[model samples]
Target: MSFPIELTAALTGASVNQLRRWSRAGLVTPEIRPSRPMLYSFRDLVALRSVCYLRSEVSLQKVKTAFSNLSEHDLTEHPAAYRFATDGTTVVVWNEDRFMDLVKNPGQFELVTINDVYRSFTNSSDRVVSDFEHPRENLSVAPDRIGGWPTIRGTRVPFDTIADLVADGDVTADEVPDFYPTVSPSAVADAVSFQEEVEGLAG
Candidate 1:
């Protein structure tokens, strides 16, 4: 399912620049040739969509990491199901009982109420979608040759503090996890692929 640049950008809500940036980030691999604009594949869109889902809906770095871990896992089991439908807004992939409790008592989930969290979550999801539409910058780095790695820039930050800033807006020096670090997109992909291979060994 190859898509033209325009269509892919529309569906993912990523801009041409952002798409290129992601490609540079090694998050998505698109086919670009000299004198040719760019081409995207369905798989690429799925990867970007997954990234967007992680940043928004869950709002928990660890949960996002778990989701990525699940993607790398060899388990063929389908993702856990919830009672409500997700229009790709706030994804709820918990077990049945936990989901039920969330829906019955929304405030427990940082939601005003379980009965109506669906709508609110979905609405807020639009921002991430839009980020894809109008990306801030184009690819800062060029794609690499075979066996090349992603180019990561920023420095590392503690996972706990990162999570706190992303979630509760509270950050204490002690809350920061000593081991949290940043990696290039290519590195992340490689690590994920390695994890997938390891999980495959159990089979």
Candidate 2:
């Protein structure tokens, strides 16, 4: 799921300038790397959103240190498959009933209550969604579905994938449902308008 820089910025709550800066610093390089058409994968999106959360609490240099710590632990699984928590100084990854301190202690963890995990995960996810100021009511994200890609609610189809069909002039607005039967014309129109607003902000 490769998304353009502008769209990625819109979804991740990171500015276009921020994304460029992070990429150059190797803090969160896009999965699809090109100066002219920067693109990022689903995992990159999760990482970037996590970066946004960390940035609110810590410095970018600290983020670099935390990521360096995380790398040593080997993040081979899908990012959405795990949960994240931080204290503005350290980063941790939680899966099931256990949590690992990725920053201050790279390979150490302890059992934690589900309530504690829920409190942290919701904080991160809430910011990821609310900070975007998304305009379309029909659009949504779910970690259990489509790796948390922004989609038309109740369906796995990405809103951008359908919006692109019109943005690139491959299909007319009315024809959107012809390609994605699950989405309505009005929903597609709103998504295109919202996407244009996002790209305009990047420009």
Candidate 3:
């Protein structure tokens, strides 16, 4: 399933504007672009995660260069699938067999290892996963399930979907349980209250 831009932004720590800019630049494009609303697949999210991490370590120009170099190599794997590292001077990618400094001759570098990049990527991915999985009380986000939205615990229903229904006044909190029998009335109320609290903070 594809995810909306808001969830993608939350998962990648990228602003909506940044995502738009990246899309325009051909740096990261969503899988589904059906006119008004854009949707990104999980692969796009993984690619964006790599882009953001690399950009943080080096300049965007260098990151772009690395991507170009990788494309030229005709690597079988996607750029995101490869491990990357930058020493503030050059970018290197692990081509499975060995590390190659894309800035220079795509050869081995003794100073850095794929382990370093792997560790950093793991930490960053963990934080992002944690943030998405537990953004608020009574809500859970499982990237492997439910399209990675803030869903009600123990159910696939998105909290925002239910909250929007109640906020529109078309469905009262008490009636929410009738529509979604899987969720309890208290859970529905919690969803409404959580949305209100979030809106209050945004205001």
Candidate 4:
């Protein structure tokens, strides 16, 4: 079922103001009522969760960049599921090969483990947000060690990778291109602008 903006924000741990800003920036546009109230679909919630995962892991700019690569069809029509650690900050989406990997090798993937969430939350002294500063560091270990895409709020990833694609306007949403999926280039540019505007506020 589709969730309203407020529920979507609650589930994603994002502020309504940020959602509005994201819409204005064209990262995750929602259907607008005649009075201009935003109406979000279940797909919108999934997309927002993806954005939240990106933000929690890297930066808001990069999240927007990914959106720019997606056409309206790709952004709104794709059936993506958002998975989060019980802590809430660690969010990942099941998409394409990654989605297949989670299902095929459930015990092997870090993000797909729901068990970890229970363990993490149970041991916490305070609420999860307080501990967002310290996320589960070892997402992947050993020689097979893989890296997660950097998000502004959750993890660190290079900005240039996404910047180059969007700046060149080389990606589209129909099929997964070889370009990085973490963030769309255009979204990155807008995120930069948004960051500047909210430099001092409690964003």
Q: lDDT of each prediction vs. the true structure?
A: 0.37, 0.68, 0.68, 0.42
Q: Please give, for residues 1-203, the per-residue lDDT of candidate 2 as tens digits.
A: 58888767765668999999988887778777756689888668777877877788777777777676655667655453446667667767774456788767777885676534433242443322232323344577567777877788667878788788888787886787788888877567657755765676576
Q: Which stretches of candidate 4 lie over 4 Å from their true place?
A: 32-35, 71-76, 79-95, 98-203
Best by lDDT: 2
TM-score of each: 0.31, 0.54, 0.54, 0.37
Better of 1 and 4 by TM-score: 4
Which 10-residue span in candidate 1 carries the lowest summed lDDT?
130-139
Q: Provide the clashing-pair count of each candidate structure.
A: 5, 0, 0, 17
- List runs of model 1 lying over 4 Å from the truth: 31-36, 58-68, 75-203
- Could you give candidate 1's per-residue lDDT for residues 61-168 as a string of tens digits? 433444434344232232221122222334333332333222223223322335333221223222111121111111112233222221222333222223333244
